[model samples]
Target: MEVPAERVEPKVEAAYRALGERVSLPGFRKGRVPRALLEQRFRGQVREDVIRALIPESYLEALRETHLEPLGDPRVEEVSFAEGEPLRYRAVVDVKPPLAVKDYSGVPVSRKEVTVTDEEVEALLQQLRERAAEYVPMEGWPALKEDLVILDYQGT
Candidate 1:
């Protein structure tokens, strides 16, 4: 993405102005730093801001222009930036491959008949009987710790 001077110069100027609005220097109130002073004191910061703003914007523009849905974040490289001039850069990125799908209608699925053993059935029945049983009062006997439960069941 090689942004021409016309585009980058304005962004650099805009970054300077935006920085001016937020910075406070000695002997001056906030947002009152002269452009020359800001350029002298924060040139590196201004360039960093310009680069940060330009890269993502240009990357998105490239993606839109190519109509590409890439897979990962762009790795930006090969920058050529100078004051009062254009921004030259390159980006490396990964993209998704075309997917291949096959064998829809003819796919075979296996079926099996479920079988339960007599022992399994009897164990399940015993569990059910214990769950359904309830305590009843004995009319003439004292309730003891050892007692037999008789469940009269008519199971479906």
Candidate 2:
């Protein structure tokens, strides 16, 4: 992928500005460091920051142009850049393979017959009956195992 110089320059400038804001030096106040000095001190970090910001956006744009969806993160390689020149990089990625239906006839499909016994049917019905069972308040005893305890409360 190639990102135009116009795109690359702005990001580089922004990176310098951001770095200048946080970096402190002996002669320069924070955010007032000279761009050339910042470049001298932090060239690699600034380039890396710009690349990190630009690559994803430019990569997605390139993918959209080619209508390709990558299966995973790209292995970015062979990145080259210069001032007043476009940023160039090679991204190795896996895309979905093309699919074609060669033949639909004689696909050799088989269906197995399913059978349910009367006992199974009776058991299913019993489960449904149990699920639908209702209990009314009974005069009497405290809750026991397997019994549902319901409570009533009033608050002011």
Candidate 3:
């Protein structure tokens, strides 16, 4: 799909201007810098802005012209620019193929019944007990899992 020549120019310019507003130089305030200064000071930044702006506009135009519905983001292949020239780029987009969708209504779907085992219940109870347990220093012996160590409880 191809973007119209007329629309491409304005979108590129708008992008350029937007980028220019974002770029700052030694002598200019924010959003007040001239395009030439912006171009000189932030060439790479401006080019990126142009790409960001042109791609969307181009994509939209292509979609409208070709009546193609795309699935994902388009892959940009090439982009190039020069002073006074229209921004140009190539993109590969994955478009939805023209096809008849099959009827999905009343399609059978299977669901499994879930059952909790005793072990699972015991594990859950053990976790709750651990959460409620408080650590206490053992006087002479190492602690064991089943040992219910006494603890001083406090709440705020």
lDDT (CA) per prediction = 0.89, 0.90, 0.74
For all predicted structures, in order, the TM-scores are: 0.62, 0.74, 0.48
Clashing pairs in 2: none
| Whole-model lDDT, model 3 | 0.74
Question: Compared with the true structure, what per-residue lDDT tens digits does model 2 show for residues 49-151?
Answer: 8888989999999999999878999999999987678999999999988789898797898999999999999999999988998987765888888677788
lDDT of 3 by residue, 1-156 (tens): 344456556755676688767766788888888877766767777557666766787778778988989899888876766545666778787889889989988899999999999999999999998899986767889768888677689999
Off by over 4 Å in 1: 98-156
- Model 2 misplaced stretches (Cα beyond 4 Å): 103-108, 121-156
**Predicted candidate 1 versus true structure: per-residue lDDT over 46-89, tens digit per residue:** 89999999989988998999888899998889988988778999
lDDT of 1 at 88: 90
Model 3 lDDT, residue 121, Cα = 100
Give the worst 10-residue stretch by lDDT in candidate 2.
138-147
Q: Using TM-score as the measure, what is the rank order of every candidate, best first?
A: 2, 1, 3
Query: Root-mean-square deviation of each candidate, in angstroms?
Result: 11.4, 6.2, 8.5
lDDT of 1: 0.89
Error of 2 at 45 (Å): 0.7
